[model samples]
Target chain A: MKRFIGFIRKEFYHIFRDRRSLFILFGMPIAQILLFGFAITNEINNVNIAILDHSKDTSTLEIINKISNSKYFSIKQIISREAEIESVFQKGKIKAVLNFEKDFGRNLIKKKSAQIQIITDATDPNTANSITNYINAILQNYLQEKNKSIQLDYQIIPQTRMVYNQELKSVFLFVPGVMTIILMLVSAMMTSISITREKELGTMEILLVSPLKPFQVIIGKVVPYIFLSIINAAVIVLLSIFIFKMPVEGSLILLGAESVLFIITSLALGILISTISDTQQSAMMISLMGLMLPVILLSGFIFPISSMPAPLQVISNIIPAKWFIIIIKGIMLKGVGLAFVWKETLILIGMTVFFIAVSVKKYKIRLD
Target chain B: MKNENVIEVENLTKAFGAFKAVNAISFEVKKGEIFGFLGANGAGKTTAIKMLIGISHPTSGKAKVVDFDVYTQPEAIKRNIGYMSQRFALYDDLTVQENINFFGGIYGLSRKAIRQKSKDSLVELGMHEISSKLVGSLPLGWKQKLSFSVALLHEPKIVFLDEPTGGVDPITRRQFWEMIYKAADQGTTIFVTTHYMDEAEYCDRVSIMVEGKIEALDTPKNLKQQFKVASMNEVFLKLARNIE
Candidate 1:
């Protein structure tokens, strides 16, 4: 145990002595949280748009006033001809164009329905999709008011509520994801690079040939990273809670426990990577390409797994971050208990055990 | 099986899927002798040293390092021996003092002992002023010397030096050999592997490996006399040329 402590002290020295890595370890989480919190938002405000109204009527003007007054959109131009719509969009100042068909108010009053085309530039599909949804809801509200005086028969009204995120704040969805990514990268990438660095510098051979057991050597190398990762997870959670106002409704202890489990899972993956890699460069490449990209792209951090294709969804199940994100979101947003997150917790535990077992076996083989 | 012998091997072999890397080699070293392991590149010198150091297991043979069985008692073997590898084995990011303390601590030395040893080593090497400096900032010769010193900090019965003097100047190499001789004089068996034939002359007994086998084993003088050469370099070349 004393020797193990010595080994860990050496590891801490290595980490603290390198300023670049220290920045990457502590600064990245805060920087990323701030960047993701204040920037990269889905909420739209003062969006530039063009209005094409064929009917110069009170009803058309009223609807335009409502859209511009909602603060979601700003009227950039009014085009008289349809040919001018294409040219306005070519300038790229406007993201959406609102078009009302000819005789819009006359038809809505006589026929009880009027067609309006919401033309949006799909160059950025996410922004376009949100813009269309917002406009559709506004039109629906206007129709509801219009039909309140006229008794329309056989009408079905659908009510939808965003349960966990009431205000639809994108930061609420991304805090857990960004925390997972930072923890994974720090624990896995840093540990793998550090271990492979020992191999490259021949210090690994010296440690292996010492009285330190292979298990001891590996644990010593990983313990410091586990502590660092937990600290990183805490900082990210605190930033999200205080700065971004993301709530942690469930037990903080359970959240912390699950985070430590995930950190161990990632550290085990790092040991597995170091066993397979002979140099620090190769270990870094494997950690970045094999671990980071998959965690970022396929772990439902930025994309929903349910909406993904079948094969990608199946592949995502193997990523521990997916389960961790689910667990964290449950605890933070839905205020779920351990009973609610037991399956994800079990999966993470199982993966941690499997990774550690495999890495130990591979490390022994390499030593022999 | 002599009481004074620190290393014992009998027909140790390591093979990698139909290719033998160390083909049935056997040798022994006494407690306080300087044993040189010489080979050309890929001549299995490293493979043999790795097995002896308890890192690599031999495919088929019996070997003991510092009286511990290499197979069953590798941990015991690890506790009794020190290893300095080819690539300057100290942590470059750590201070010289920290490196010494770290290595000393891992060998289960007491903190007081570590402090005393660090002081003695720094003063002995005339590097007391630079003990707090980062090892990476030091010159290559100093790093190699410090690595050797750290490897011996635990006062192990045997020390394995795998190409410890690869890229240093001749003066540093000579100084390094003097350190090795000083340790041997203190009754620590030294097993060193080197590609430099001139360095082999300083060893009490030298073994030259050719194609995964020990082609010649004798004193540098006896090997030269038996091979009818004036220098150890000619002796190594004559043995290497016979393989092709």
Candidate 2:
């Protein structure tokens, strides 16, 4: 135990003394959280649009007034000719164009239906989709307000509610993902690089030839990183809660316990990487290419796993990050306790045990 | 009971598939003598040293290090041996005192004992003033000297120095040999591998290896006289040429 403690102290020295690692350990978490929180949002505000009102009628003018009044759209230009809409979109300055059909108010009165064409630039498909949806909702709301006093014979209403994130804040989704990415990178990449550093600097040769057991050396190299990763987890959790107003509705203790398990899982992966790679550079490449890419692309951090192709969904089931994200997002968003997350918790535990077992078996006792 | 010879091997071989890296060769070293392991590159001097130091297994052989069987009692063998590798083996980012303490701790030394040895080693190297300096900032010669001293901090029965003097200047190499001699005089066996033939002349007995086989093993003087060469360098060249 004393030997292990001493070894951990030396590891701390290596981590603290190196500037690049220190920045990656602390600077990256806060920077990533802030960048993801304030920047890289999907929500739209004050989109630039043009209007082509051909009817020149009271209802069309009233509808145009309602559209411009909403915070989502700003009336940039009022075009009279139909030929000019294409040229205006060709400039690419406007994201959407609203066109009112001829005799819109007369058709509404005669047939109880009117046409309003919404032409959006699909160059950015997501923004264009959002523009169309927002316009549709506004028109629906305008009709409802207009028919407040009169009673319709039959009406069908569809009600939609965003359950976990009511505001549809993009950062709420990103907070969980960024937290996973930071933990995986810090825990796995940092530990792998450190272990391979001993190999690169010839310190591992000295270590292997000494009285230290293989388990002792590996655990000693990992303890400090486990502590650091927990701190990173806490920093991310606290940042999301305090700065981003992300709620932690479940038991905080369970959240803490589950996070520590994931950190150990990542550390086991790190040891596995170090065993296969002989140099720090190869270890780093493996950690980044082998670990980081999967966590980001397949873990459902940014993309939904259910919507992915069948083969990729099968592959994602094996990634520990996918289950971890599911667990934490459940705890934070749905306010669930152990009974709700036990299956995911078991998956993480099983992966941790499997990784630790395999890496220990692969750990070499001799230089060969 | 104690034995006079600290290392014993018979028909020790290390092979990679069909090719033998260390052929069936054997030798013994006395308790308190310097054994020089010389070889051209890829001659398997390193592979043999690795086995003796308990970090590599021999393919098919019988070997004992400090009375511990190489196969069955490797852990016991590890506790009684110190190793300094060809690569600079000290933590460059750690201070002199910290490196000493760390090595001492791994060898299961007491805290008070590590402190005492750290002080003594720093003083003996005449580096007491730089005890707090990072090893990487020091010159190459100083790092090598410090590495040798750290390897000996646990007072193991034998110290394996693998190319400890490579790339060092002649004056520093002389100082290093003086340190080795002083340790041997105090009864610590020295097993060193080096490329410099002149350094081999300083060993009590030298063995030259060629193509995974020891071609000659004798005192440097006798080996030179038998080969009819003027120096150890000429002797080495003649032996290497004959092998081709």
* Best model per TM-score: 1
Summarize candidate 2's per-residue lDDT along A245-301 as a digit string, tens digits.
887888899899989989988999999899899999999999999999999999999
Regions of candidate 1 where Cα sits further than 4 Å from its true position: A56-58, A103-106, A144-166, B1-3
True contacts kept of each: 0.95, 0.85
Q: What are the candidates' C-alpha RMSDs?
A: 2.3, 2.5
Give the Å shift of residue B164 in candidate 2. 0.3
Tell me the lDDT of model 1 at B130.
95
For residues B146-178, what per-residue lDDT tens digits would candidate 2 score against the true structure?
999989999988999999999999999999999
- Compared with the true structure, model 2 gives a TM-score of 0.94
For residue A267, what is the lDDT in candidate 2?
A: 92
- Please, what are the lDDT tens digits per residue for candidate 1 over residues B92-180? 89999989989999999999999999999889888999999999999999999999989899899999999999899999999999999
